[model samples]
Target: MSLKYRDEREPIYTCDRVVHSETIQALEKDMQGVKISMQNRGLNVDVNKLSALIDGVRLDKDKIRDSLYENLHLKGKVNLNSARDIALILSSQLGVKLRKSRTGRYIANRRALTDFNNPVTQEISQYRNLERLLSTLKGLYTATDKKQGKVSCIYTDDCPSGRLYTRDYNLQGIPELGRTVIYADEGCTFILADYDSFELRIISALSHDKYFKDCWAKGLDMHKKAVSDMKGIPYELVTDKERKLGKMLGFGLSYGQEAAGLARNLRTSIHQAEKLIKAYKSNIPEIEAFKQETIEKARSTGFAETYFGRRRFLPDIISPNIVARKKSERQAVNTRIQGTAADIVKFSLVALHKAGFKIDTMLHDGILVTVPEGEVEDSIERIKVIMETELEGLKLIVSCKTGKWWSDCYAKPGRESSPK
Candidate 1:
């Protein structure tokens, strides 16, 4: 089918004009303020503690290695870091039965090792995790600006998502535990306004999925509602685990996950994963149809567009290579969902700026604003209004919180907080 491609210049030009001028200026100023605040209230890293942890991890690793060497009667020291070495030692030398992993990784790195509760494999995994943590800490330590007494992250506006990216220190890449080291400027509390289930809500609005819309309308937990609908059970009767599984499946659908991938992620049987996917599709047939239509459209047109008409050219969608074509198909669907979410976030940032909210940071689906203690309540309300209003034709439930530090802003239902 010869498909007509929409003039890509229009959407690109529109996005450039909208985001390049005042939006960039506002973001620049926001980033400057954030950098200064971060410097002034420099993040505290306990080097001693991190070093101790590293030492402990090394000791544990050594103990495991010594035990393994003795048990297997190995001739020389084996490199545990080498997946090949580990596989040879376990499979060939030690006569440990190893299953073939689909990922083509060593048996020790496979999911089956965790399922079988292999102590040796678990120890190796623990060692790797600790080594990763140590590397991250080292990076942070080296990146710390001694003159400014803070880690200054360079921001870029080049991301297609219209969201900011941090270079050098990579502030956005910091793990939750790492985030605890950062503190807000004294007397100036942190206020986080996160759009709950932001992209899923956008997808629901876009597809006009009845189950999703009905759940949102009734102020029900969307994940729980999905489980309830899928299982034909009362929402209250759905367990937390079931709700989590439902939530995973719901979000995974947006990423074009197949049954095998879902099964791997949820650590369930392929049959169970298929059943979950079936349930979700049965509950929201429209969304499934929409996704299929999107892939077909992209396959025909060599491109797809987001809700606001942002085009993503997908020539690979029609590629002869199965892997490349499948990837492009997934990207086509994801671009519509994720790209729209990005547009909404960008819109929210611009709106929030015009409304005079001090945007500390713009996370993937959340905005961290700094508000004075007295103005926290008012700021939260205004932020909610701006974010919700900017995304016209959609009803989203935004959650807000106040905290003395960034880590303190644990998301809750309403505007209630114990700002420490």
Candidate 2:
């Protein structure tokens, strides 16, 4: 009957929070000292400056070549171990300990299902826990409902506090490209990353013109309209329900789904679903361009680069098998664009954190950041700038809305509850 204890019936796990930030900072300071010692040995390297340079640099071709080969003296090959060493060195110079990878029972269980086959990768992380690590982690992760102790309808919020509860309509879930057996699940697990990116891209593209209409009419404003227009069976809609659906639909289309799954879920015909998809895409050519740009860039560059020096190889775009090739193309497309979106969010998080924004929840494209009332507006502007400027070439239009209640948070207006 109560929702606060949603996870109470399930196993709970906590981790050593110290390893992530605090340890990194300590290591950084120690590394600075180490640099001085190494300089006494004649290395004379400016570790801090070097680390800042690496973290601040984008992982483009020239940067990668120069950093890995020229600076680090690794020619023609590299490994994760080396990457970590470089990161560690940089962290020391910056007077911040890069978070040490931790392994333990918790880490094992978390990666168990996804990486069951890799015993080496599945090894429990080996990071030392400092004071009160478990307790701090537990305090932060306790499950509590949005409404303290009331039987309330599930609604969306912009900055929801407490736990989240979704009513199960028992709708048949559609199968996504990679994952099999899809149905509505608790939390945001089944949400597709591609669909989320596509929806945002569509909104971003359409919002470019004023009093101007295009194909799907699915700009940010139109998204508000479409979300507001949703109808459900027993369908007495509540405030947060529409926003929740909007988020779902947004994530759905982001993954490149056609009409089958959506129509089935909506109890609508596939034809109608196709119509909606086409209309949405037509209205937002910019979204289409985003997709095209990512694919083209990935194919040309041979790797997907992030704002920082992180790089993911994109070797499959030129696969030989038709199915494999097409799949890789989609992967390449989604990874670059979606990955860039991730970079923006991460950049925003680091910047906001530096500016004192306490980030509570991080969804794929958006974030749930909580700051003192006096600092919310400034934090918002800082985040917007971070997201926009972090990615070098992409000119993104990021907006936010601020409200007092759990429902008042706004990345884009019209949503009362935070993203589910």
TM-score winner among the candidates?
A: 1
Provide the lowest-lDDT 10-residue window in model 1. 1-10
Model 2 misplaced regions, further than 4 Å? 1-220, 224-253, 269-272, 296-311, 320-323, 356-361, 368-420
Compared with the true structure, what per-residue lDDT tens digits does model 1 show for residues 1-420?
011123335323433433223333343445455444433433434444445545665576677667767766777767766777777867776477666559976565646456657676676666566566656766776776545445656666565434566677777777654555555665677787888888777777677777777777788998888888888899899999998988898789777899999999888899998988987888888788888888998888787766656567777898999999998989888877887776667667666766666666667788787778888788878888777642335576688877765667863555433233
Question: RMSD for each model, in Å, please?
Answer: 5.9, 24.1
Give lDDT tens digits, candidate 2, residues 1-420: 000111223332221221112322332333333323312221111233323333333233234444434443444443323435434433443333333345411222222212334322221111111112322222222221223311112212111111111222101110111011111112212111111233354334423432123313434343444444444222233345555544556556456554777775665789987776665556446656666766677678665432222235557767677776566666654444454454344444455445554443344455544445566566656666555541232245455555433233322356533232
Whole-model Cα lDDT per candidate? Answer: 0.68, 0.38
lDDT of 1 at 157: 54
lDDT of 2: 0.38
Q: Return the TM-score for each candidate structure.
A: 0.80, 0.38
State how far residue 216 of model 1 sits from its true place (Å): 1.5
The candidate 2 region of ten consecutive residues with least summed lDDT is: 170-179
